[model samples]
Target: MFPLFLWTALLGSAALEGPESRLLCTSPDLSISYSFCGGISHMLSLGVKSCLTKDNTKDDLYLFFVPKRDIIELSVAIQVWFKAVQVAKFTEPLCRGFDDEYSFCGVLKGETINITVPFSYRKFIFPQGQYTVLFEGISGRSNDLIFCVNATVILK
Candidate 1:
């Protein structure tokens, strides 16, 4: 009887098909803007319920926070070398590491609102072969929304 109950609970949780997570948020009334120059673009904002920052003496990051069933999406516009890219990183308080490439904005709600994060990565440098943007999502287990944004400029 206990085994059957456990199986049922597991199945029920699996069936909860929530909204497909997106890397960017584009409401018909909302649009993010940037100033572009020298193969680089600037991010205006990232919408979500998380904290995000970048380590750059010459560059800056624009962050957005949104709520989710379990965690939050930390979206940011990354400027490197002379190019820009948008990426979403998910974080749970219980989790130790960040999951990169969790999702990219591929759908749009309207012509003016894009569901996917925009990226022009031709000018960024990742000296370590890859650069990652990190953030902390809302988690009940931990109140410390310790978010981090880092990129290893690998010029390949």
Candidate 2:
């Protein structure tokens, strides 16, 4: 019958393909682990989850948070491989809502916001290794600690 013929074709093609023909690939189930660095855990939650992308070459970070206080300016320190480095420090303005790149910029205090940040590793040929990143934030005006997130990423 035609039904049996169609089924054979479908199964035959699927078995022929390899991992490179991945239709849907995802990382292992992961949880947001606690870090020794300080953070406003009362209102922020961070996690790493595999998200589908066009190229299927990168992973993303998911953040759901509510700000406890008004934030105008932000300072960030990103440490790779769990080591401190001066070059990884930077400062940027918060709440640039007009820019489409930051759709969650206009969030108000007590309002919940969820956003995804992607890590694309295809452009640069990264060496095979286990990499971990630590992101620490401080309030620009008060110079007080706000949040710290540490995550490990594996690249193949």
- The candidate maximizing lDDT is 2
Structural similarity to truth (TM-score) of each candidate:
0.21, 0.55
Give the root-mean-square deviation of each candidate in angstroms: 17.0, 18.2
Tell me how candidate 2 scores on lDDT: 0.52
Which ranges in model 2 have alpha carbons more than 4 Å from their true place? 1-36, 47-55, 82-101
Worst 10 residues of 2 by lDDT: 16-25
lDDT of 2 by residue, 69-101 (tens): 545545566655412222233555554324524
Which 10 consecutive positions of candidate 1 have the poorest summed lDDT? 35-44
Number of clashing residue pairs, candidate 1: 19
Off by over 4 Å in 1: 1-56, 69-128, 132-153
In model 1, state the lDDT of residue 144: 31
lDDT of each: 0.30, 0.52
